[model samples]
Target: MSGLLQGIRIVELASWTYVPSAGAALSDWGAEVVKIEDTRGGDPCRYLTIGGLDPAQSRVDANFMMELGNHGKRSIGVDIKSERGRDILRRLIERADVFLTNWLPAALERADLSVERIREFNPNVIVARGSGQGSRGPERDRGGFDAASYLARGAVAYALTPPDAEYPVTQTPAFGDLQGGITLAGGIAAALFHRATTGHAPVVDSSLLSQGVWAMAPDIAAADYYGIDRIPVGNAGTAPNPAVNRYRTRDGRWIQLVFLQADRYWKGFCERIGRPDMATDERFVPLANLVANKETATAELRHTFAERDLADWQKILADEPGVWATLASPKEVLSDPQVVANGYLMTVTDAAGREYRTAAAPVQFDETPPPPRRAPEYGEHTEDILLELGFDWDAIIAAKEAGAVL
Candidate 1:
């Protein structure tokens, strides 16, 4: 069966994970996405090698990072600074249902590719843009990357770091990029839907900073209403809810329990851990008493959990009434039965006939997902695209010779 966005076409003039990853999502949704890059070095992400993996080890033209961001898109190398290149983009925009870019306002102005100019080519086209910050502000023209704009500026870094740590802990790679890209794709989908019903094209804009703030909106709003500085989470002991805590197993593995309804689950939780005496103990019988002696209770639970391995605890707690899960590493998740059953991971083979597993998009339809496709080589479809744009071989050769396209 076809994806939800089978016939939609997207012209993406963006680079790096922050914006191009949205094209990846669209491609997964079966949109025909054509990624336009400069003829020189192409997307800089092509050289990225994660976890110290050698770039030369990659079977595909791009390393895993580039593939993860740009998969299933047609690649065209065009120097937009040139008149002929700009004309090519205009023609592509004319035929496109959506135009996506991450260019700053100054860069857009310099290239004469503003929203108005883009709409001139196709009045009904949806102009979707990704940015580090909003379009208007003191730093509107400043270029943005996910780390600087999203985590740092949006209060995420401040909130995530442990208060007692000597230094702030680092966030995972592309944490904000993936989220921001997904947000942009969702906005684009909403814009398309709006246009389909109202026949009015709207500009869709998404920014990492905005997304970061939105993700923490509840905490920020609560802080504002309380007229106090945000609280720092130094450790499990500092967590507002004692029921929500992590305990170490005898095997050194960690299990996190989050039973919000503490009163309802207190008896069962204590009984399952073979600590029935603690549940009846006057100091811990009532929820308020337990909270008042949180340290003692947590220490006792930790001691109890340390008496058995994770496997033993898993079996003992399986039928107990509480919300809990083992802390799993990425490798563990790769082999997780639930993830496998849901098809959250997929396999793809590169041109060299090498097979590897990759993540599927965070969506499903009719219990199925789109097959993962490898990213294209640089300018892989330039000739075919030029032909589709009504340029014959002679004309295409001339453009290539003139350095307008690759």
Candidate 2:
């Protein structure tokens, strides 16, 4: 990965998605990230079996899940619990610009890798901590996953789930973790700027809970102001503005119109949809009249849209002032013309040399995204990193023999 942050060095001592995600984003921004993995098999996420994917279902049997947060980092296996391993880490930390971790507070204390100890190795290096709950709460020491802290404690489930439903809707896989990762990446970038300006590095922290709160900030604020949890979810047929709802097409596709200012485009929208009569009809002229007869207006609009497929409607309203978009399915979105034209998605090879499509980080530099490389294999860069750290071949061999490194 090469773009901005080209000379930045990040020592990533974390596993799984939450914090590693920040490292991944930093790597995407052209940072030199060195992932320090444990000696056994590296990050445990490398071997995790997801709920629905089966090895036999695919030809490559590769771990795409692990690749999400790891695709551009170099991996070196070291048993940091050992003295020799800790010594090797110190040497790396001494040269690093950022020390990133997702270890729990208690875990840091137990492993003697606390922030105070880390500062002793490099006073000016930034310490970026990613966690599930937070650093100062009563539950700070308690471990948490995104499901526990983000969806549950952060009120996301409550905000999303219907009151009449038996169970709250669960988040799609790693949604919260990925959001947290991107948020943490932004925080680290800000910390870097702060360091450059003040001559002192500030500790950066972000968490799944923080991200969840941020995601629902608008809803939370509305709730606080109105003294209510939320306004009830409205149905398309009952929408106050017919232009602000979705309608089904002939081929069973759905298209949403987002005309917040309904009156401004009401006539043009009706003309484009081959319903000029409705535009002149007194019952549906102004937005207030349309709302008074919403059920009827919705039915007429749905029937008019059903007369044409998505392709026809696309052309009919392609240049209209009204904002409209097709409700694309997961499969349809991949081949969307906008996605292809903008280079939002890309293909990258994995460690096993299998080519797979992955999404680019949201931001771009010079209208270009960083090219991704495969995540390193376990201990793949052990000798190279050791040599870089000024260790002789003999010393490297000795450390391996003593179980300090893989």
Candidate 3:
């Protein structure tokens, strides 16, 4: 079967995680994505890395950029600041179904690449823009990263660290950016579907702050009902329940135990852990009592759990009633059997012929599956694309000489 977005074309005039990630998802679903990069440095992410590297190696590799948001897409280097570059982009947009970007409103206005300009060029094109905040917000002009977005809009400051800790560390993995990307992709897809049906394009705008609001909805809703504000509970949840916290195993691996309905599972849990008396104790009988005696209950549970390793606990609780637990770690999750069984990991080759394994797209459709394609080399498709755009070889070379493309 053909992919969901088989005939759709996307022109990505974006950099970094937010907009590129959305384009990548569209590419995975089989849209033809052409990533437009500046002729000089290319995307800024190409230079981002974990450790210092040799210049030669870094330029050839560009590992960080390829890994995050360039998968399943083609790259074209063009100096969009030039008139020829602008003409090239306009030509591409004329044939594109979607134009995705993350430039701020001012930057878009400065570049003359706003949705209005895109619509003037191609009225049937869906314009998707990702921003730090809403376009009309007071802080819209302010720059934001995952950390700032999480702290400001997500209320992450309240529960991001231990209560008594002096400093709170931001979560890595660009949480807000990724969430915003996913949301933007969803909106773009919806808009594309709508356009397909109605023959009218729509603007899809998303923000890191909007994504954060969705992430913290549960806590925010709880805050409205209760007079108390939510605070960091460390490894514990905000459920006001003791059975839903982390427990230390014998080998020091932390296991998360989450039994919200303690009344249904507490007796079985205690019996399984060889603590029958605690199960019948009035102080531990009801949910309120268990929550009230959280400290004592947690200590007892910890002591009981420490008698066995994580594997042992897994075996003991394999089919037990109401006791759901699992060991947590990034490595463990990556190698998990369920993930592998579900085909949540895929392998792709980079420009240098190096094979890199990465996570696959999460969404699934019975008739349309995501395609796996390598991220393109810098300006790898420049000549071919220009030729497709009706530029002859001599014209292409002259354009290159004119610094219209790199």
Runs of candidate 1 with Cα error greater than 4 angstroms are 50-53, 56-62, 232-238
lDDT of 1 by residue, 129-177 (tens): 8999988889888888878898888878777776776776566668899
Off by over 4 Å in 3: 51-65, 224-239, 321-323, 350-354, 367-369
Ranking by TM-score: 1, 2, 3
Q: lDDT winner between 1 and 3, please give it.
A: 1
What are the per-residue Cα lDDT tens digits for candidate 2 across 1-406? 2469988999999988888878888888899999999998889888877788786786563566667788788999999999889999999999999999998889899988888899899998999998988887787887767887898888888887766677887976677888889889999999999898998988888888888899888888889999998656653234667778889899999889899887899998888778899999989878889878878898899899999999998899889897899998877868899887777766776547777766666777787767867667778899999999999999999999999999
TM-score, prediction 3: 0.91
lDDT per residue, candidate 3, 1-406, as tens digits?
Answer: 3278889999998887877888877777778999999998888777666445555664334465455587788889999889999999999999999988878888889999877888889989998888877788687777677677755667765655566667765665555676677778889999988998989898888888778778878778778878567732644323357688877789988777779788999998888878999999888989889988877887788888888988998888888877575866867877789776766666666567776566555666673446556677778899888888898989888889999997
Q: Measured by C-alpha RMSD in angstroms, how accurate is candidate 3? A: 2.9
Candidate 1: the clashing residue pairs are: none
Cα displacement (Å) at residue 299, model 1:
0.5
User: How big is the positional error of residue 207 in model 1, measured in Å on the Cα after superposition?
Assistant: 0.6
Model 1 residue 58 distance off true place after TM-score fit, in angstroms = 6.0
